[model samples]
Target chain A: MPDATEGSATRREELLAIAAGLFAEKGFKNTTVRDIADASGILSGSLYHHFDSKESMVDEILRTFQEELFGQYDAILASDAGPLDQLEQAVVVSFEAIDKHRDEVAIFQNEAAHLLTFERFGYLAERNEQSRDVWLTLLRNGIEAGVLRDDLDVELTYRFIRDTVWVAVSWYRPGGRRTHTEIARQYLSILLEGIHCA
Target chain B: MPDATEGSATRREELLAIAAGLFAEKGFKNTTVRDIADASGILSGSLYHHFDSKESMVDEILRTFQEELFGQYDAILASDAGPLDQLEQAVVVSFEAIDKHRDEVAIFQNEAAHLLTFERFGYLAERNEQSRDVWLTLLRNGIEAGVLRDDLDVELTYRFIRDTVWVAVSWYRPGGRRTHTEIARQYLSILLEGIHCA
Candidate 1:
């Protein structure tokens, strides 16, 4: 049996997941604490015991997801793989995150801009820069290594790849016909070679 | 010096532009005709003088934008350019539209899913299919021409390119230091050869 603090933490995690689903389906501004409470079948008072406010719950949610995501990115960056290999690993890992954390990804993508205005969510911007740095580092290394094309524009190229990979969260469903690995393979194929029929 | 009907049409255009900006900013479901009229500094009654309702205004805005955009697409499709050149032309034309019709593009990007529930906006889905066909045709032609890599997954490749190109509307500003053509050139370089230095 779980102790009181453990049970409380478990309950808190469960409630946050429910709130995230609601926030993702309905815009964060449109979703109320009452809606989340109602969805969780708990009184608003019970929710408050777990979270001081909705903002805190969302803050925790986004922070927790980013922590895990950036940890993976940090590992990829630290790996001794060649620059091109590291870039490929990064893309694959990103698709895997979308598959494994679709709801959290959706909520963050939809809400980050609106949420980041508050002082509590300043880390979102930092994570954005961190993500850019990870990609930019890999790209610059690839250029120096000659594995990637010399003529590519690093900043615009980063945005293209970043946007292309993350926007899939809007439509990608886990356990669908294509697994994350399959999607990553196709994406990398198109990225490496122009889609023309040589 | 404007005739009454011409003046009315000009007023209608201005109102539609205002409505598009609001719809893009606040979302269509959250925006009301009253909000639009208020933003335009006119009474709701005067708004109706130009537009029957907010629905009519949105319909007209979307219809006109789509007509013009599709006309350009059709011209590109029917042109005598090779597959690779056609692909480049299509990308340039798309960025041009993003530059010239930012508001309409924003509205379509943000509201197409929500708006498609109504009968009047069914063409949004059709337009999506039409867009897929346009890219697929170009991709297939490229394959037959032996200019592109044959191992690519054309459908996934099309989605990748489409998402990368269209999502720029979210962040792109027309008067930014980089012109749309420069952005297009940067994108073209990455799309063709990728971002490795060697």
Candidate 2:
């Protein structure tokens, strides 16, 4: 049998998952602690045992998600792979995030702007800058290595890549007809080779 | 001196512009007729002299914007331009829309899903289908003409194009450093020719 502490930890995680889903579907500002507790089939008082407030729940959710995502980016950046390979890996990792953490990705996309206004969420703004830096570094390296087009506007290119990949979360269903891998493959093809026929 | 009717018409247009900006900024659901009246520096009763309700104001705003935008798309589709030219022209027209009607573009992006649930906004859904059909037609024609790659997943390609182009409304400003034409050109270059150096 599982230890009582282990079972409680599992329950806490389950509650966070439920809260994350609600936060993603209903805007974070619109979701209440009671709603999360009700969704979990528990009393609001019981929820307080796991999380102090909805803000705490969301804070935990975003913090955990961003940490894991940035961790992957750091790994890709540190790898000895060529600049082109690193860029491709970065795109693959982003799509994987959308696939595995759909709710978290949506919450970040939809709520980060508003959430960043709070002192507690100041790190989100830094994460945004860090993300820009990652792409710019990959792009500049690619251009320097003579893999990416020399004439490309790095900023615009980064924005296009960023927008195209993340916005897929809006329409991309996890188990839908096209798997995220396939979607990433196709996007990479378009990004690496012109859609125009030779 | 302008006739009273012409003066009222200009004021009506000004009020709708203010309402659109608020709806874009605060979200359509959060914006109230009183807020619009306040923004216009007029009494709510005086505001209602032009529009029956907030819904009416939004309806007119969306209707006018979509009609003008879709009208341009129709012209491009009906033109004798080749499929490749047509695709490029369609993209150019879309960025132009973002530049010219930033508030309307944002309001539509942020509110269309919520607004579509109402009976009055039924046409928004149809407009969505029409947009899909427009892009698919362009892609199909390009494929048939041997200009675009035949192996492309037309639906996915369309989504990428649509997402990247329209999502620019989030960051695009009317008088930004780059003109809409320049942004469209760079985007088209990336879309048509892969960012990879030949």
Candidate 3:
């Protein structure tokens, strides 16, 4: 027989994906275990076997996405790229994530504040801090390297980029008109070169 | 004695303001007309004397805000300022609006999409199109004026500016640490000179 533990883990991941989709499409407060199970074509009891509550499933879904995303950010920070290059890479990678994992990004964007209120989801605050640190570090490094404007407010810049990029998840439909690469390229253009014609 | 027509109109405006505040705080779908009436210390029937329905109240609230906002935009377009100057003024005026009419902005941001699907709210879609036109015109004019970089993608540039400024409604308290002007100035700096040290 196949490994029961491995098979169960795969099944758990599949169910989580289904739940994430429902939570994203329908608001988190509006979704329930019954909705998730129905969407996944499983009985509600079977879903309970995988996750104790919808909250638990959504918690796992968001936590996993954050871990993977922050891992990429951490690696970029640790890389040998210069500060400006690093910031650019971070933006590019972020847009890519939005394209690749649009549903997860959407869920986080729409539901994170509500989730963060619960003690069980305290890690969301940490992720927000970590995200801030990544941008701050990059901006500080750029200032140090004399590549970014010294007069720049790193906090404001971080918030600007963070808000601008993540908010795209709301209207960013993949396989639509603009490809992710094109969108990123366009954003980086305005971001780096300024939009004034000169 | 107050003119009865004018008094009723004033009362109607006050009720909408109360409803807008509640909608912004609790979200449109979650907010009930009863709650709004209770907050206003009036019975639902009394409130209905001013507004036929909750839908009509919201419709008035959003329509009034958009009309005033877009009137300013139209004036800017008709102004003698250069494209870059026009863009700057538009940004400043937007931030000013956010400061002066925050609850309206928040409600529009949170509920416009949901509201726009209804036949009565068709103008929301038109307002969006008008907004895009305003930004795109300014961007394209800047490019044609040879002030902004010719390579810039006007559409994406429009979106970046749009998202960055409007999403501030989520966290932008009117009397917070930074004045809207200060925040707008810093944002304009980053938008124009970018974070790159030069």
Q: In terms of DockQ, which candidate is strongest?
A: 2
Predict model 1's lDDT versus the native: 0.83
Per-residue accuracy of model 2 over B1-198 as CA lDDT, tens digit each? 545456455777889999999988777766778898898898878986888888988888998999999999999999999999999999999999999999999888877866787899999999999999999999999999999998879999999999999999988887778999999999999999999987
lDDT of 1 by residue, A17-97 (tens): 899888776767667888999999988788888888888988888888999999999999999998889999999999998
**Candidates 1 and 2, the one with greater lDDT:** 2
Give lDDT tens digits, candidate 3, residues A1-198: 435357455777888878888877776776778888888888888877777787888888888898889999999999998888899899999999999888899889877866777899999989999899998998888888888787866787889989999999878898988998889878877776666532
What does candidate 2's lDDT look like per residue over A38-148, in tens digits? 999999899988887888899899999999999999999999999999999999999999999999998898778667778999999999999999999999999999999
Question: Compared with the true structure, what per-residue lDDT tens digits does model 3 show for residues B62-176?
Answer: 8889999999999999999998899999999899889988889988887786677689999899999999999999888888888788776667788889999998887788878
lDDT, each prediction? 0.83, 0.90, 0.84
Which residue pairs in candidate 2 collide?
A: A194-B194
What is the DockQ score, from 0 to 1, of model 2? 0.69
Query: Model 1: C-alpha RMSD to truth?
Result: 3.2
Best by TM-score: 2
Every model's DockQ, to 2 decimals? 0.51, 0.69, 0.60
Rank by DockQ, descending? Answer: 2, 3, 1
- TM-score of every prediction relative to native: 0.87, 0.91, 0.88
